[model samples]
Target: MLGSISLDKTTRRVSLRAKALMIFSILLAPGCLGSDEEIDVFYGEDIVPPRATPDFVLFDQNGDPVAFNDYLGDVVVVAFLFTRCPDVCPQVSANMAWIGNELGDNLGTEVHLLSITVDPWYDNSSVMQNYAYDRGLEWPHLSSDLETMEPIWRSFDVGLETYANDTDGDGTVDGFDLCPDTPEGEQTDADGCGVETQQSEGDVQTMHHPLYYIDHTTGTIIVDRAGNQRVYWGDFVWNADMVLDDIMALVEESA
Candidate 1:
């Protein structure tokens, strides 16, 4: 009986060893772990080019033609947003406003804020004017016809989608809607867009209601005085202070 038990134990040990070897072989086999080149291709990091501003021309909120070349000696922060955006767009614009206020007297002189509307058709001069006024944004809020705006959007990689919905039951579908189901007479951004804000509180029992804006991309391009595009802050993650610091650095470098 002892001899038979020893034989069974040895057989079990051999089986376990074989299984381990098979698993190792599969892991190290060709096409199993993938080649080094293939791994690099899959996991490699992208290298972004150094900032340099590109040439552009569009109409401002007043229907006045504006060109990048016109501001050859000044620094410009160009942002893409629609007047009616409910989410990140408002945040981005607000941040820009903060930056502008921080800059104070140097706004249009040393630094210029150019907000290009993604929704050109609905965001005409008057609509853009109201948006600017409501937000107290002193910068140029501009848009052009679709034919002109399409290429500009492509150049900036700004993607926008329009939908039709009558959330207010007012018998008219408004432009720039993220959630078309919202009821009418509800307070919204300049574009009559989606919900205004979102809310989240801490672990305590108290309630916290924060502003909720739309989910639009928040990419603001910073162009230096040398016409080089220096920095790009995507989404609303970047605050006014950080943007201002970079701008100051660029200004010092230019000087």
Candidate 2:
């Protein structure tokens, strides 16, 4: 179950729809490994990240420049996202929102979260801000031009990923398909959408760019006090309780 928020801010909807499924990284059995003395130092998908996250200068929702170091002294949960992604990313954000709510006093104190875009070409600071606000998000939703963000993606080892909307469940993608979101189970033409697909609201594209909508990377990383990456989960396949346990442990340790 997703945890509840008790922070100073008024309670906000956590999901577009109620009680969305919560996903985490791959799970590990508690006793599957050897015994008492050895510590379960890492959880979910383990990573060998750099001693500290590479410093990044990116644009915030307000179009102002912000850097990674600005969040120093707080353990940061960082993820890469794109606005139009239809899948995993949205759920990931919801999960983070739950975490943020749970953090309460710890937020901006012991913990902070950052989300950078993989499709910065399409998701400018303005677009990103709208996306974050729509989702009732509190963390930074950041981006820059594709050229400026490529190095950041490289440093984090995440590739650009997106998908086209087939609003009518059409077999083909939007741009070349000329039609999109074909009605479910309906037989479609070569374009994979029906003749009326154009009338569908999905036809309109965004302001800055026309990139494919994408799925989230389904990963999150935790950086500790010394700036070392402490944990990483490649997908939302594990448990939030475990994450909370680990995060609280780290927060106390850092204190």
Candidate 3:
């Protein structure tokens, strides 16, 4: 776990406990003598000397152009996911939804949430729309062609790759395969496993479907009202309450 800290754009930082104590005594406590401003500390990895988030205009689930700059005055939470992802993507989405619900009336006003696809080749505007609707997520799920999304992905430090892996020599790529372990040189079904693997007997069924699996960084970034990336919480280590605290802290900051 990365230690938290209180940081500002000039790379000035202080220990979390020290800053917490200071804030409590000077900013929160009654009759304390100090400036009216409050210092914020985060529970996630802080971006020291924070930098501006790359701005882009992408189509949302509704096929309407959405610009990142338009959300400058709001704290933004950006999540990277793909519609076809079988595991981590959905978990990340659920985490984001939890944060969204906790935001309450502040959502879409003081805080903006966005989910951008890592597999834009497959997750077009319609696919993004369907995914969002099916999952009951009201936030914008953005998608565009690979050419347009690559630079944005790079700017956000999103590590991404697509693979056509067939671990058991099956004709079908692992992405679309329901069964993963097919025998060598055996014909497979649409699900990528032979009858021997699927049924109780040794028989080879012939069918193939080509697909690619996308592996990407499953993390969410919190951008401050200044449009700078401030905190990052990886999907595997997310704590909903801590994430919410980080966001609200930024929302409390003066513009």
Candidate of highest TM-score: 3
Q: What shift in Å separates residue 174 of candidate 3 from its native position after superposition?
A: 4.2
lDDT of 3 at 229: 90
Candidate 3, residues 108-127, lDDT tens digits: the string is 89999999999887899999
Error of 3 at 30 (Å): 28
Deviation (Å) of 101 in candidate 1 = 1.3
Whose lDDT is greatest here?
Answer: 3
Tens-digit per-residue lDDT, 91-151, candidate 2: 7787788788777788888888888888765789888989999989967888888788877
lDDT at 169, model 3: 68
Decreasing TM-score order of the candidates? 3, 2, 1
Model 3 TM-score, 2 decimals: 0.76
lDDT of 1 by residue, 1-255 (tens): 111124454345445544543564476677787455321110111113434456777888787888987887888888988775656788888888777876666678888889998776678888898998988887889887889887776666566665554455423344443335545554443333323331123212222112222234438877778776656777646656556655554444444
Off by over 4 Å in 2: 5-39, 49-51, 161-192, 196-218
Q: For model 2, what is the error of residue 201's alpha carbon versus the real structure, in angstroms, after optimal superposition?
A: 17
Q: Which ranges of candidate 1 are over 4 A from the true structure?
A: 1-47, 163-218
TM-score of 1: 0.61
Cα lDDT over the full model 2:
0.64
TM-score of model 2 (CA atoms): 0.67
Which prediction has more favorable TM-score, 1 or 2? 2
